[model samples]
Target: MGTWQLVLVGLVMLLGLLGVLVPGVPGPLLVWAGILWWSMSEKTTPAWGVLIGATALLLVNHVVKWLLPARRLKGVGVTRQTVLWAGASAIVGFFVVPLIGAVLGFIAGIYGAERVRLGGHGEAWAATRTIMRAVGTSVLVELVACLLVLGAWMGAVIHG
Candidate 1:
């Protein structure tokens, strides 16, 4: 591929990483699309194996995130409702205040709900801290997921 094409791919990869920091962007999907666009441009297309692996790398990050957390949460005694509320708040927050609001909103909503359910501000704050930790880890996991997509794209270039 031309140097310009590689530059564009690099830009897409950067955007994918940025999307990880800000909520609501489909980072992995965008990364995959960018890589696929490049792969299709080459005369000798990327191997089917490499393409499949890249797709899996793009796909499995989300799947593992969803499955692993729910299982671990069950082991640790956090309810599904807590997770649901956190997600809902995150979504609502995006509309309400945009950008950083979603992250804060999720944490605040979880804490608020826990306080109402627990009936003590102190206990509620503690539960909120726990939820905050979980959300933070999830964000980190997402960062790693985007990195994996970048790796897969590079691998396609090297091995194709």
Candidate 2:
């Protein structure tokens, strides 16, 4: 890739990393797309290897991000409906309040769902904490994976 292309790819990857934090941004997908673009453009062994590795990492991330939280939630007796509610609420909150509102809305949504289902504040709060923990862990995993992918891209760039 040309120097300008590499720079552009880097900028796009950076945006992807930030997308990991921002709701509805499709962060992992963006990162993958950038990497794929660069790799195809370069058509080198290192680039291909990095692309494959990143593909695996992202695949694992997607699976685990859903599974771990779901398992934990199930273990704690959290219903799928509650999770759905939280996600729906988070979407609404994102539109209603923007940035921070999504987080706030998610918490509120989960709590509201749990409260309605369980009919107890304490139980709802406990479930909310567990959900938050799971979310945090998923985000952390995604962030790390994205960073690793970025590193791989940079390494290919440098070594290419």
Candidate 3:
């Protein structure tokens, strides 16, 4: 890739990273698109190989993000209804309050669900903390995976 193309790819990767934190933005898809953009422009074996590897890693990240937290929640007695409420709240929050609202709404939703189900603020807060931690862990995993992909792309740009 040319200098300008590399710069563009870097910018895309940055946006991909931001998308991980922002609701409604497809972070992994954006990262994969960045890889595709770079590989298509470079057309080198190493670039293509990196692209394939990143794709595989991203796929695994997606599966793990969903399964790990879900398993943890289920193991801790969190019901699917709570998760659904949180998801629905996130959607509403995305429209009502913008970028940060989704996260806030998700937290509130989980807390609310637990409060209703368990009938105490202490227990509800505990559940909220658990859910938040799981979510944070999932986001961290995605961020790390994205950073690795960005690093690989930078390496390819430098060494291709």
- The best candidate in terms of lDDT: 2
lDDT of 2 by residue, 1-160 (tens): 6889888888888999999988788899999999999989989889889999999999999988778877777888988899889999998998899679989889999999999998999988998999889888888889999999999888878777
Candidate 2's C-alpha runs over 4 A off are none
Candidate 1 similarity to native, TM-score:
0.79
What are the per-residue Cα lDDT tens digits for candidate 3 across 1-160?
5778788888888999999988778998999999999888878899899999999999999999898788878877999899999999988987899668898889989999999999999999999999888889889999999989988888877775
Q: Give the whole-model CA lDDT for all candidates, comma-separated.
A: 0.73, 0.90, 0.89
Higher-scoring candidate on lDDT, 1 or 3? 3
Off by over 4 Å in 1: 43-49, 155-160
Model 2 is weakest, by summed lDDT over 10 consecutive residues, at: 65-74
lDDT of predicted model 1: 0.73
Kindly report which residue stretches of model 3 are placed more than 4 angstroms away from their true locations once superposed: none
TM, every model: 0.79, 0.93, 0.95
Clashing pairs in 2: none
Q: Candidate 3, after superposition: displacement of residue 54 in Å?
A: 0.6
Using TM-score, give the best candidate's number.
3
